[model samples]
Target: MRALRYLALAGLLATAGIAVAAPATYQLDPTHTMVLFSWNHFGFSNPSADLNNVQGTLVYDEKDPSKSSVDVTLPLSGLDTFVPKLDEHLKSADFLDATKYPNITFKSTKVSAAGKGKLKVTGDLTVHGVTKPVTLDVTVNKVGDHPMLKVPAVGFDATATLKRSDFGVGAYVPNVSDEIKVRITTEGHAEKK
Candidate 1:
């Protein structure tokens, strides 16, 4: 009886030690992550801007994609329209009001595999002091070790269309266009620990 108990205890310990690993968490590589936005300008053209200095964490599960989650934050200070004056104007109270509300954030509530290498991510997006539900069509680019860093990494491209008026940034409305298209290309490095 004593020997049997010892064997059972050892087996339990071994099973516990080899338990399935949870989702891997990765730190967003700010230098490799960019957010681009475009909107119609008075029916004349579709002006575009890029947001830099994005920071976030992505928890990915290969076997079970539904277990994945993502949280990202983009600093309004990183707004860049190439034109300095336009960049400043975008950060002003008339637009994003970067001085008061400095960050735009998104936190995933649900993640589901849409098709091969594609995902439907539904989340809450907070911008300019307002929070609204948003969904992104995400496509996985690659997932493996980085050649330079020699560390685990993942890359994806995602897009979403939102109305600026929904976030209360409707400065020009129908003229400047209420609809905005956002694109994101991001790379994440696996977090050690």
Candidate 2:
């Protein structure tokens, strides 16, 4: 009976000693990320758009998947529509108004597991001083060691739809595509704790 009790205690200790995997927290490397947008000018014609100088961080737990989230912030002054005159127009009060509102940010409040590396991210997106609830359908591309940086990296693709008009970008809406389709592919590096 004494031997059996000792064995049971040893087994319990072994079970309790099981190690948990480490969580990953990565800082968005803007040079490795792309922020692209496409919209229709008329009914079916496509017009392209892009933004730069995006800065943020993404935190995720691969072992414990529930502990994952993202926070992305982009400068309004970084708005680049390609066309020289159009870029100025976008920064005016009728649109993003770069002078008044310096940054547009998306902060994730919850991350839900959608199965098989897919996640549903719900967050508060603040743009042009208007805050709104936004949901991003996200896919975790991979989490591994990056050969170049010699650091652990996390890759993911995210998509979200925004109504420009709702954010006070109502000018020329019918002419300038009311629905904006955004795609973000980010590769971020995790720092050593």
| Candidate 1, superposed: residue stretches over 4 Å from native | 1-19
1-193: candidate 2 lDDT, tens digit per residue: 9999999999999999798776678999888787777777767687766777889988898766668778889986677778879788778898888899989898989888888989899999988999898988889998899998889998989899889888888787788788989888889998865
Q: Output the lDDT of residue 127, model 1.
A: 92
lDDT of 2 at 17: 79
Weakest ten-residue segment in model 2 by summed lDDT: 42-51
lDDT of 1 by residue, 1-193 (tens): 9999999999999898686967988999999998999999989999899999998999998778899999999999889999999999999999999999999999999999999999999999999999999999999999899899888999999999999999999997899989999999999998554
Measured with C-alpha atoms, the lDDT of residue 120 in candidate 1 is 93
Among residues 3 or more apart in sequence or in different chains, the pairs in candidate 1 whose N, CA or C atoms overlap within 3 Å are none
| Per-model CA lDDT versus the true structure | 0.94, 0.85
- Global local distance difference test of model 1: 0.94
The positional error of residue 152 in candidate 2, measured at the CA in angstroms, is: 0.5
Best of the candidates, TM-score: 1
